[model samples]
Target chain A: MTEKIVVAYDGSENAHDAVNFALSIAKAAGADLIVAHVLEWSPYSFLTKTEVEERHKRRKEELERADKAIVSPLLQEIQSSGVNVEVMVKYGHIAETLLAIVKDTGASQLILGRTGQSSLTSRLFGSVAGSLAQVAPVPVTIVP
Target chain B: MYNKIKAPVLGALASCALAAPAAASNIDEAVNEVFANSTGWFVNFIFSPFPGTTFPWIVAWLVVAATIFTVYFGLIQLRGFKHSIELVRGDYSDPNDAGEVSHFQALATALSGTVGLGNIAGVAVAVGIGGPGATFWMILAGLMGMASKFTECTLGVKYRNEYADGTVSGGPMYYITKGFAERGLPGGKPLAILFAIFCILGSFGGGNMFQANQAHAQLTNVFGDFPGWITGVVFATIVFLVIVGGLKSIASVTEKVVPFMGVLYVGTALIIIAMNADKIGWAFGQIFDGAFTGLGVAGGLAGALIQGFKRAAFSNEAGVGSAAIAHSAVRTSEPVTEGYVSLLEPFIDTVVICTMTALVIIITGQLVIDPATGLYVLNESGSIQTVGGNSGVALTSAAFSSAFGWFRYVLVVAVLLFAFSTMISWSYYGLKAWTFLFGENKVSDLSFKLIFCLFVWIGAAASLGPVIDFSDASIFAMAVVNIIGLYFLMPIVKRELTSYNARRKTGEIKKFK
Candidate 1:
């Protein structure tokens, strides 16, 4: 079976670094690269009806912006690298959604960039990389 | 003992604003008279009683509609109760689904709209007028009203208009017109138009003014008597900022704050109830005895039933079709799932929260009792005389404060959050109805928001009598038109429910967990 390398990307410089790292690993193993971006969303948030009605439109716009502004340029630059690459964007917690993507894709390994500073929420809860490293079924790599 | 304890505690934090200046009083009186005089006819017409009976026809209209929907749907509120909880828990939701709103968000929004001053102040009015017996009828009406919500919301989603821009609009207006035309019926547009007009009025009355009035009442209870216009001005400014100013940040802050307040309010009630643990049975007994015998309540059995049904409809808005506007925004392949989800709204608003308020009032012995005759003390006005001359939110606050003097302070904060959150939600609902009638545009949107903000001040400046009468009438007027359309469109919902149930049985609809 062909190998799959899952990379969590959020369009930051750190994410760019993680993508570049994962690309090298995929090339060495002759594997396909899966790029996943997860928008942080909690279902528990209270919203007004107007907000609720406008959410789907906002969500579509966000997804389109992420693809066009963030992923497309990266994809174009990586195209000449001669590796099969795909992208997935979804709304959910970054760590949980990325882990789900890892399992769903049956990837052989998981990789992500580690940010130098953690968000207050991440500090209160746990950081995404820290969470993924502990729970991922496959081998996990954190690129600094 | 409770009164003595409360007085000194409140005295320490009392404001000197108790005495209003002549100028403010003059303005308040003028605004109050103008509003009361102008809306008198509309209120009277909507609340007109049936010939030879004291029962308002509109209350009967809602109760009858709720009863019919209950029977028509085979008590779906009970049969589908488990599934409704599961649907709200996201058990049947696909995480990757591209739905506009989750069941939880839809329910929460709708709840925020319905579960406000109505639960706090409206129940006080019901019990204050109809005695503890009103509680029994209120819960019964709430249970049956669930089915009404189920029908309207199902039709709301099924007939909703989805735009290319990914935005959607649905409610009685969309469903009435679309569902009728789909069934080859004429006059759907006219009925939908009527529903929209009443919806706008309802939003102004129950959704805007009543909330303002009660918030002011609770404030006055804490700070001492002040001109309503003072409270009105402050409320209008804040509402104008949020709704018309498009200060999304303020709206978001309230959204976060209101849910916390709801939990806090409920937690406080639970604590008060637990404190008076022995009175639990006695409170239930009062509720039951009042329900049947009326316990010297004016109009007795009929009076209790009318007040109960009226307050429940006002509070939960089951057949009123306003919630349909909120529920229609939910994202689901099967519109019936939203119907199931909508059923829980009345259950939560009326059965759980409203009942809690009633129990707290009764348990705390806020209602004055005639020890000699074993009946509620009635004043010259023929309504039960409550402690502290309290009415509306003041009465509910008094009940809480009676348990612990400091509870009134916590209640004041909760009441403000509830009232403010409700106004914000209703502004959107009214705007939706307004845009539907005048055509969605910046001009119409600003016009309605301005009018709504104006009413916030008017509501606070005006006396509770006219404001509440107008609120009850306008909201009930929406029910009158919406229920007529529901009768025409219910078969469509039944078919959806049948297909949904069959699909669920065969595992066509996947359960995620």
Candidate 2:
């Protein structure tokens, strides 16, 4: 069976570096590459009733926007490469969701950027890379 | 990204913050004059008394409607109450559903909207004038109002406008229009239009102004008697910052803090009641005695009933159709689940929380009970006299402070949080109605937000009497139009309930937990 390598992507420069690192590892190991984009969302967070009502709509808009502006462009650039690539977009905490994807895909390795968007939030709440490095079942790499 | 959003918002808030204090004196009178003159006719028309009776027609309208709903729904509120709790606990929820809100979240948000000044200040006003017996009526009205909420919310989900964009718009207006058209009724559009108009007015009076008025009253209770416009301007500035400045962080912070305030308020109330543990029996005795006998108050039993129902209607807003908007957002394929969830709102808001407020006021010896006649003592104005010669939030504050001095400070914090959260919820409801009538665009949205914030100032600057009266009248007007639609569309709700129940019994509706 072919091995899987997962990379966390957030359309940041460090994310591009992480993706390139993951792609090179996938090529060497002859493994499939998985590009995962996790929107930072909390089902537990409190919201106004109006915000709650409009949440589904906003989620849909955000997903479509991300796919169009971030994931699609990356896919185009990487399609000509020999490695099999799959892109996943989900709504949840970045670290937990990426780890879930890693477990579900049975990937042998996990990779992510050292810094991405929402650095301030990461600084306050602890970064996704910091979280996954401790708990990930697979060997983890932090690409700078 | 944080700085990108904060810079503009802080700039706007700072400018308004500076301007409000500087122009306070003249702007205060100008705003008051414009508001009273423009809204006077609408208030008077809505509050016009029934011929040969002192009771307002609007209050009678709500009472009759709630009664009809109770009978028509076969007391669904009582029968489905356990199921309502179950639904709220996520017993039957499908987590994978595409709906925006969970049953618990929807119920919580709706409760936060309704469980504000109405429970605190409105209850005080009720017991202050109508006597402790008003508590009995308030509880009864609250129970009956449950059926009204269940019916409207069920219809709200079934008839809501679910767009391809994944958003929804629902309330009395949508149900009236869509339900009527499906039933082959011709007057749906006109009735829907009328309901929207009443809803907008209700939002302004009850949602914006009443909250501001009572928040100002509580501030005055803590501080000395300052010009209310100062409170108004300050509230208006903060509210304006959140609503128009797109300062979502403030709004979200307020929402998060509100639930804690509810807990604190209720916990403090329990402490006060425990301190007066000896008087619990006598306080309840007074409620029963005052309710039936009127205890020498003006209208007697009927007067108690009127205030009880009025306060309950204002507090829970069951038949008023506002809560339905909040409930409609729940993530349930079974509309009946939302209805069941919503039935818990009035139960929690009125029967539980409002009762606590009323009991606290009674047991703390706020109302002066005449020892000779076993009746409430009345001052020269013929209104029941309280210990501090106060009313509204002040009376409630006095009752709490009588038990624990520092409790008043906590009460002030609770009042501010409650008022702020309620205003935000109502602003959304009012904006929906505004967009429904004038069309949804930036111009209309901005116009309504400006007007709503202005009323916050106006509400604070105005006296409690007219402000409360207008608030009652406008909110009751929403019940008038909404109940008409409920009367027409209730059979549909009954059908939904029956089918849902049948499915649950047959095990077709699987329990998740």
Candidate 3:
């Protein structure tokens, strides 16, 4: 049985480094690598009735494009490396969605990178890796 | 009981501060001079009295519109009042619906813009000029204006434009243009341009300056005669910081502060009213008497009616079409639902809060009715002399301080907060109108905001008369163009209302919670 490991990816340079760090560990342990990307979403806005109605369409197109543009290319590279791999995209706060995917996939471990935005934004929104480390169901490895 | 404890305490302070300052006299003069000049002839033309009566035809314009909307909608304000409450409470709200704010939030935001100084000071002015009788007509107008709000806001949502970037803009401008195109009518573009022009001007006058002017008056009353320009500078800086951040900062502050301040203002008025519980009957009697006979007030029935309708229009802003812009941003699939939610605005603002201010003034004996003449007392200089010695917010401050003695301090804080928040919100409204005219570029945005901030200072330093006259005229000008568009768009609103009502009867508009 291949042990499950989930990599929280955001398509950043540091996130790519974390993916490589996770790959070596996954290869060593012969585990399935599940790459997850959580989009940051805050719905409170001042919009007109029409803008809001069309937001549904815009949100759908954005999610589809994220998969086609960001996740699909990565999925091909990982699968070609001859390791069991899959990609997941969820829309919500980053840390919470990553943990949710971990529990749903029954992954034994979580891996992600320390984004360059760790200064003020992480302090304000709470850093993804910092949050996952605190309450993640599995052990969290944050590649610096 | 406190009379025994307070007699000597009052005597001790009376001797300590027996003289008043000379700057106090100059402050009022300078402000009044600027006010008269700023408003000038344009306002005089708009407010010019009718040939046979003292009432301005502008008053008749709003009253007639409110009455027509009431009749055409089959008293929809009354019919939909209950559903309106439910809509605001989010009974029919869908989480998946495309909206930036909830119905309650939209109403609260819109209410903040209308409810501020107009409720506190404008009511005092109306009662001062027209006597307590004006309150009767004011209440009637508020009730009628509910129907007008229902008409304009409903159409505001139905004809809104949803841009490709998931941003939306709606108002009389959008509906005037689009609704006309749909009906295959001409002159929509010109009407839309006219509405935008007036909307921008109205934003500067009533929505910005009047608020700043009154807030400064309240502050100067408590803090002594600092240059009005100094107060203007302080207020302008705060407004700049907020509006410069765009909608994000405005949205955050208005959502929290608007409702709290509104409740605080109403709560204070209720306490004053309750304290004078004995005078409630007399107040009501005075209002009724004044409404019909005018009790020998200068212009009699015509005077009271004119001031009542004019102030109520300024206070609640039903037909001026500004509320439609605020209401259009609510999250709801049904446009009529927003209309229902918006009608509560005038009710809370004019019918409830405004009436409370009028009651406090009357109950506190602030109007000074003359027993011999059965009219307001005339000054030694042969001018109308109000009980508080002046009109506007000063009259209201006197009314409140008569009861609490220290309530002026509380009122200054309230007025300042009200003025600052109003400036920030009106900046967004003005920007929307500005961009509609000047294209939505960075330079256009900066220039409009710069002009808006400068007006904030000008408003604070100016006198009550000119600021108010200009504000009233500019806001009324918006109604001239907007109401014309609304006349053409009412059939569309009727069709939408009928369809929504039929669907609501079958539970197609389901309650999620």
Candidate 4:
């Protein structure tokens, strides 16, 4: 059976590196690769329901582009190596989405960039990662 | 037994009265007397400053100017609200760009500068004088301020100067001159000079002295009978340590301190609100009523609105051009991106944090009005005192204490942390302004740091009333120069916005990495 590995993706170079690292690990373990991206909802965007739907559509397009740019290449490379791969794009806050995906997928391992799309300060993950580490159902590795 | 008890009780009362003879001469009463005496002097100063009923006239002009600008710019602040979220999300962040810090760090540093005493003491002063109605005007001012922050920060990045050492310098001075010069406009150089002057003065008073004074006061109050000199010396040492290290150090410290203190303070407030959830409705009602009632202690609605707007303007400094100095250092190549992040500042500082403070104060019935005197009685003294008289801090502390009695100590820690962070940020701002006037030589930098440190000591040691009032005036005076620059340079902002939007639409812009 293929071991399942989840990679946190936010389109940053560091995050891309982590995904590449995850894919490499998944290929070594003969595992399926899951790519996840997190989105934060801001209160300032007080758009109407119709406007929100439009915004979501636009965001989805953007996400798709990111997938094309980052995830697709990795998937191709991993599949070429004769490994099973599955893409999971989850949307929500980074930390919560990450922990939830890990639990639901029951993945044996998780991979994340040291810093994602967020600024360097927030990437410390002392609060986000520390909390996740405490309760995460699986072992998580942070790739710097 | 009854006689003996009565005698001792009476003796105790007499002793208390004797011990606090100066208490009868309350601080509020003294302040009121000073105000009454200064009424004539103020009247003369206002009238003589290009004459005919200056206070109301200036106010009328400010209202008209703000209204016209809001209309003329098509309420850019509203548009900025949308962009600000995008900025924080790193939508416009470009790592390959030439700058010192990331957009988020720049915003955090700028916020650390603007969001200090203004949120705490400024709000207190507004609510105390203008009653709850001040909050409404404060919100209005903050909304209008979005355009101001957007304009200044965009210009800041656009006109930034890259030094040989990879350092960047930009603000109103750069924009007023460079932007106007590029557009072939007249008097750009002069306007830039004027803006620089106001900015320098503002840095010394509002940014430097004001922060120090409040920190000193809060520390002394918490640590009873502690010498003011001790407060000054310790704070000055800390300020010197961080500020002398320049923007990199300031960014590092603020990036950590801002989020931690912000979350801690906001979290404490949330706990208080949850505990007093039942009073939330009444608090909102009072805020609305006090805002429009036109029955303030002095000039009624107009007075309240003026005070509220003034406080909010002073607090967030959305248009003051100071934040641009910090935002200019953002690593992003896109100026509008930093502008978007800058927009969040007012929302966080005024809309969220300030609102939390106002609700806590109002819900606790601290803004009590004496029917007989039409004055706010903020404390048990029965004398009408404005909330800024330690009462504001005390009231907030009381609210926290009510929810988590031990949390007041946490608040003290938070305040000190906030105060220290603010001081460091402002020191950098002043240094930049100082460098602009003087050369950027090491001696010039050292001299500015020394003077800034001295003021820190003075602020820590002195009574808050005079220094705070002066600082408030100095900070507000920056608006006079900044708003003018913004008014002239707004077309540039619009052009940049259009181009940015076009790029976003065409899918040329990639998602933030």
- TM-score per prediction, in order, is 0.95, 0.83, 0.76, 0.69
lDDT tens string, model 4, A1-144?
657888887767878788778878877777888788665543222121112113434555656776887668767655775656677664455687788778777788888877633655555545455556677788888887
| Residue B345 shift from truth in candidate 2, angstroms | 1.3
Ranking by TM-score: 1, 2, 3, 4
Looking only at chain B, model 2 earns a TM-score of 0.94
lDDT of 2 by residue, B1-513 (tens): 334544665566457545767666566567666777777888898878788988888777877887888888788888888888787676776533423466778877888899899999999999998999999999999998998898899998888888786788888888999999999978999988998988888888999899998998898789877777778778887888788877889888888888888888889899889988999999899899988999987688878878888899999998999988887776567888888888998999999999999999999889987899888888887779988899999999999898889988988888998999999999988988888899878879888887888788789988787788788888988888899999999889889988988999999998876
Best by lDDT: 1
Task: Report the candidate with higher lDDT, 2 versus 3.
Answer: 2
Candidate scoring better on lDDT of 1 and 4: 1
TM-score of 2: 0.83
The TM-score of predicted model 4 comes to 0.69
DockQ category of candidate 4: incorrect
Pairs clashing within candidate 1: B133-B290, B133-B291
TM-score of 1: 0.95
What tens-digit string does per-residue lDDT give for candidate 1 at B1-513? 333433442343132223445577887788888988999999889888899888888887888898999999899999999999999888998989733477888898889888898998999999999999999999999999999999999998998989999889899999999999999999999999999999999889999999998999888889988888778778887887677666788888878888788788889899999998998999999999999999988999888888898899999999999889998877777999999999999999999999999999999988899999998888898889987878888899989888889989988888888899889888888888888899988778877887887788889988889999999989988999999999999999999999999999999997998
Instruction: List candidate 1 stretches off by more than 4 Å.
Output: A119-123, B1-21, B98-100
Give the whole-model CA lDDT for all candidates, comma-separated.
0.88, 0.86, 0.80, 0.66
For residues B221-324, write the lDDT of model 4, one tens digit per residue.
56665545456666766666555533345435444656677787778777778778999887787777767873443446766787777778778887777888
Could you tell me which 10 consecutive residues in candidate 1 chain A have the lowest summed lDDT? A115-124
Query: Which lDDT tens digits does candidate 1 get at residues A20-63?
Result: 99999999999999999888887777887778999988888888
Each prediction's DockQ against the real complex: 0.60, 0.32, 0.06, 0.04
- Predicted model with the maximum TM-score: 1
Q: For each model, chain A TM-score?
A: 0.94, 0.92, 0.89, 0.74
